[model samples]
Target chain A: MKGRKINPKRFEIGQLKIILLILPLVIFMGMPIIFIINHAFKPMEELFAFPPTFFVKNATLENFSKLIKFSDSSGIPLSRYLFNSLVVTVITVGLALLLTTMSAFALAKIKFKGRNALTHINQIAIMFVSTAVLIPRYLVICKLGLIDNLLAHILPLVAMPVALFLVKQFVEQVPDSLLEAAYMDGATDLDIYLKVIMPMIRPAVATAAILVFQQVWTNMETSSYFFSDDSMKTLTFYMNTLVNVNNTVAGQGMAAAASLIMFLPNLILFIILQNKVMNTMANSGIK
Target chain B: MAETTKMSRKDKKALKERMKHLKSGKLERRYARMGYIFMIPWFIGAAVFLAYPLGSSFWYALNNIRITPLGRIFSFVGQGNFTQILIQDPDFMIYLVDYLTSTIISTPIIVVFALIIAMMLNMKIKGKGFFRLIFFLPVIIVSGPILGMLTAEGAGSISAIDTQSLTSAISSVLPDIIAKPISDVFNNMITTLWYSGVQILIFLSGLQKIDKSMYEAAKIDGGSAWECFWKITLPNLKSMILLNTIYTIVFISNNSENPIIVLIEESMFSGTKEKGYGYASAMAWLYSVVVLILVGLFALLLATRKDQYEKQVKRAIKARKKEARNKKKIERRNRRNAKKIERQRAAGKITTHTTDRSDY
Candidate 1:
């Protein structure tokens, strides 16, 4: 083992091995997407066919077209729903990132007596299910007069301790010497943080941002409690209506179409930022 | 040492003073102060947002408090909600069984799958980055809203359309061999996309940190490729496996993922004036206990296996040492025999040292 170097001879074999390695990942990754797309496109007859259709075509955009035009008689507007989702998601992501970064910076660089206790408490909070906290959160929301408001969804989500945990882990990797150097150069504590710390921990922040956004956007539990109006519902609530409320052939088709559409933005986001997001997650101790 | 001993007391005292001054530097004190200032946000957030809510929820779970649509609170019944869930609810058992079964099956599969996929992603290959992107995409998009929209009826119907029928008719015009599995495969694919993201990330990171030397050493010792993976790779992944298991159990067991539980609660509480929140909380607590048990069991397995692994490494080291000793003795014997042959040649006598070094 000590005498080994890069083997040019085994390169071909390694490449082949890599192909073999990737095939299942492709299946695992590709299959679900392909299924969802197919489900979205297929007629009911094909969806429940004894032998399923992977490539049944005459694929039309009618389902998607009809889905986009869908508006209930209750005036439960999809656009309003999308807007609410965006608002709540933005608040959740923005607050979560801000709070997490500050706390993480403190935990990593600041020498404090209770630092370890706080860090460990944050870790335990990671395992504390939002479900476990749901009832109390509901009570709190009502008490705060936030019930039925979008803030009800955003505020509790920003409390997510995992974001703090991730940010702190990332900030820990930024050498203390860097902060000292900044201070030596006559930078204030706030300036050092804004200029040096923020730049260094950018990757962690991006990873945390994506994670926070996804969690808030896709969240149903918190939203379900806070928002009752169908018009006030997020896209997920709208999708749920197709499956549980409508439950017809046309409804299922629309549901499938909406599911695909729901995936489109995040899918696009993932595709665009995946390299950075994954690499940052890897660096930020997500693994 | 003499130089240090000969150092002037004045010089030593000055150095000590400098060290003490360094310890209480203004910069250090300010940094410490800044740290507290920075931590205030998270500290405040956690106390108000997390701890307070958690403690309050526990209290709410113990009491029967109802909130009207208009945000009005009804009278509280002490311990009634907990008792109802513990003793009176039928859906409690059903949810428990559903949750437990799903958990038992999904946890292992997700962890193992994540491990395998991570290993694959870690390998050197063409389009490795591309594949990673694909694997992670499912996780990104399969949000509840997105999935809900995809499954929505009028919003995004999944029913068979006239065009689908036409395509099927056209596809039936083709051979059965290609069409059958493709269709079935496509229909079920999207449903499984939601859970693969975390698994892939876990596995990829686990694969990244495995030492390359392990494979090199195994190969040099005439070990097969498969042997290298089993001996070196699997044991190293134990902690990762534990993490993914716990994550999977928690994610799957959560009522949010399985909406059917809520529907059942609705059914059980349909005719009654009760909200069944107490019953649901009780069930949640029980399920959380099961999760804790699962986590504990996995930890135990990891601990025992780690011990076994350490022992095995020790034995391997010992065997290698013994083999090295034997090889050294054989080499020494060969050297002595060669010396004797050289002397015999000098004396013009026949030599018996005919062994080939190549054969040895």
Candidate 2:
């Protein structure tokens, strides 16, 4: 696992040239992110300052405290929304990882009738914009009697086609000889899936997990469409309502605080699992 | 009687062979069954979630649906909603045109920008991971309402750029329809670039996979860095470009911030009797078709054509084969002519002293 020693390129003056070119873009791209962070910490007077300050002059936690107080005053506390989001995200990510990897294993390794057709179906499913299927998907949820249920959020997002595609590609790289050896030792298909395939394709699973987590965490559609009750809604939905209802000048600080709260989890998760995510994308291109 | 006996022997042999084949395939059949077992959840999920919804959505588009207190009422109105959205709804058409143009304009910019950043990050530079983390931060936090808040607070653009003069100049030169989306792209340049975070990583991974020896070989062969990039790097990364382009298109089209998607959501829950589930379904159907067409067009545009170097090599090989075949053909024709003359001379039809002009 040692790094290669004889690479032709070295860190020289040429490297500084690239740094110069990229430094400006990196700063440009990082501006909004910096702005988001600074905006959240700004006190009321600075938030509404003319010619809007790029950095916070009077940085304080007042906006966050105000946001917490406002939410506490409401009947449904912000904690309830956060709890709901966590539960939904956890269950969705777990179930989606299981279903996607298992299905990918079958499609990639096993010789079966209609396997190509199933893969084709999944590929075509990737092309479907979720908006196109909204009404009927809603109808399906209603018919299943999951309208006010938490399962409504978890079920619809479980079958992710792109995740399946990526994992299946990773699974195909599992040599046939490895599977044969496992089978020769009297292991069943499920055993191989759990012990061998699962261990090897960990990077892909992590990638899929991150994708499903982001999808479920940020998704406000289910709460908006399926659930009519406010108590059952997620943090994102609540944040959105908070920002929209109080669009007055006094509400800007609180809105900025809420945006930061929602953004922090995703940033933290990516920072932790980024290497695995990069590994997964390394094999994602169509061959 | 003899033929019947032979035919019976052949039939029995065929039956025996069939039995052997079936016996040999028993293990494969078991594996196939196991494959189906593993696939059971997906089968059920696809049928219920994907197939049924698609079928019902198409049907919903054709019907006049009413969600009432007692029960849902469905009055079948064939193409009524489609025509209404196509002809009557001004917002739908305008938003559709805007979505199409902006998507077309921004997709390449996003992809190319991603490629440039990826290439920069791929170099042997200091703090590569730090730069990557900065570049990729956008993908994590980019959601509808959050982005809406950011843009509303004027954080979507650089303060230094005078977008007013730029927009004015662009509008003066071009027509209104085309000019508007281009200016919008410039205005939200940061946000548009943010869309490329995932694309940048995708490109970076692809760049890493390109064998370093190819570049070394090119350098040894006296190829300039620019030449090496166009010849070696670009061709190898062609498929990745196509993949990233399609991903960006799908992502942008389905994003919650997309105006067309917001429009559909509004019409779906609109208080008006005319605009409800049925009308929204029709609008979604139209919008998705546009998205699919855009994806198809970009796919076609970036689809890996046969490599130019390989094509030229193939052409040269084909020409050599054709030349060899032509040489053989001429030698055979000369041999035949010589043989014919020798036979004629032996038969005394022509003598060496009196050579015929036809022999030449």
Candidate 3:
């Protein structure tokens, strides 16, 4: 795949032009994450420096050890928060991808009563900001007595409209003949959906999965709003609390470490799936 | 005997023909039922989590809402809350203007920036995937608090060169009005780049879908690269551009750190339950109106008539499918109705004259 030559006629831009144009942007974008990662290893005094030290003089595990020491006096241990984030992110993202992909199939492939109407309704939901609905959503959660419950946070995002929309756009590219062939062989909608369509739209799934996983992962505000229980707190919530607590020299170092810990999984995931994600996104078959 | 004799000959023939298992509409309905079943989970979730909450926001906005000791209470207050937020609240108005301005300002910059990067990536560049990865990496790391912090000083200038001095130097050379936004985009370039992650992906995908022959055809016809882009690439990307615009608007405006959102939250949680929730909901509604209008304007600018040919093709395809479905539906309905009459006749419920609709 790597050695295959690219067609110059594709975008008709000079190689140097692309390089010159993208260099500034890539440098601008990549620098901060590098700093954040480097800052995590700094000793306490360096963390406190203004016009902050771009690189730590000496890297140490003191921040993480300090984080552990501080958590000893807290209501829930830090590891529990990490576990909470992991459990919720995995389940919610999985459920969201399944539900959205299935829905995208039905809406994109199957013609039924009210199909257009339903798609439009969901599109309108896209424009209508979710923040407006927060109070009511909170009330809806409370009415079901799910307050202080992790389920409360997870349930709301399990049917993601944005992800569904993306998958639908991708699934529409799936040849109708494929579904018809499945139908000819006696595959039901559910069967076609699970076996045939889902496999075809893998890139959309990856894209949607990445999106939802990030949403669930970096989520700090919503969890605090819904769940007051300490044990149910997410890693983001704990990190926020860690960052805001007293702003001590040791605390800043620990906060940096926490940022790294929180940032690592996503970074690792990005490295793994980004190419597939880009390919899927680019998979729109215009030809 | 007379009741049986009074039955039309047409009905007798139809009923005689109905005794087979080929009443296909039932089977089709069964298929539809399966489709509905497939949709049920999303429908229920959307109703409960999305629609119900969306509807309730308007209700809460209109009413005087509060949490009572026993339960939540709502009294109709008409436009009282709306008026208060738009007309009375100073801070809400200020934040509203700021958020609205930011969204209006940022939407195009992000979309165009993403489009350029996407087209750039589409070129025959070495390390295409590498560049794509670099563009997309920020998406994963940019959300939640880290992004919020990075933008705040958010990812404050990590460069040793004084960002303040840099901006002032640039500002001194250029007019302040021109300098402010240019500096701002530079200051938030990382954030801007991060925001474009998905947009770039979307545009790249849209670019990929462009048929190779369109380019070949243009090339054969003596179309230059710039002409080909305007005629082929830009037109093809119109719908995707429209989508990216709305997405950027919603993403940027509704970000947790947006002062407007912060104001909405502070009012909802920190203000008294009686006054706070209602006013907060009203502000949120105002926020919704602004977002929708901005989105509407973008859609109009990018989407108008660009997809008209595509839309007609799609509509033609849909219309054909609908006609086929309707024909099958009527056939099934007629067959099923004929079967029902046969069953009723067998059960002795049809003791009077009957006629086929076709005969009538």
Most lDDT-accurate candidate: 2
Query: Model 2: per-residue lDDT, tens digit, B242-332?
Result: 7688778888888877888889888888868788888888888888788878888998777747878889999999999999999999999
What DockQ does each candidate score versus the true complex, computed on alpha carbons? 0.24, 0.41, 0.34
Give the winner by TM-score: 2 or 3: 2
lDDT of 3 by residue, A172-249 (tens): 877787778788999878788887777666656777777888888887656877887788888888887888874775
Full ranking by DockQ: 2, 3, 1
Instruction: Compare the candidates by TM-score and give the number of the best one.
Output: 2
Error of 2 at A52 (Å): 2.7
DockQ, Cα level, model 1 = 0.24
- Model 3: per-residue Cα lDDT over B239-302, one tens digit each: 6787688778878876776788888888776546446677778778778887778778877777
Query: Candidate 3: which stretches are off by over 4 Å?
Result: A1-17, A72-75, A145-150, A175-187, A278-287, B1-31, B68-73, B124-126, B147-190, B212-223, B272-274, B307-360
User: Which scores better on TM-score, 1 or 3?
Assistant: 3
The digit string of per-residue lDDT tens for model 1 on A149-209 reads: 7777777778567567656655765667777777788888788778877766665676567
Cα-based TM-score, every candidate: 0.66, 0.79, 0.78
Q: lDDT score, residue A29, model 2?
A: 79
Off by over 4 Å in 2: A2-14, A75-77, A105-111, A165-206, A228-231, A248-250, A278-287, B1-24, B27-31, B152-155, B158-180, B211-232, B307-360
Best by DockQ: 2
* Worst-scoring 10-residue span by lDDT in model 3 chain A: A278-287
Off by over 4 Å in 1: A1-13, A43-52, A72-77, A167-206, A228-232, A278-287, B1-32, B66-109, B140-194, B202-245, B258-275, B293-360
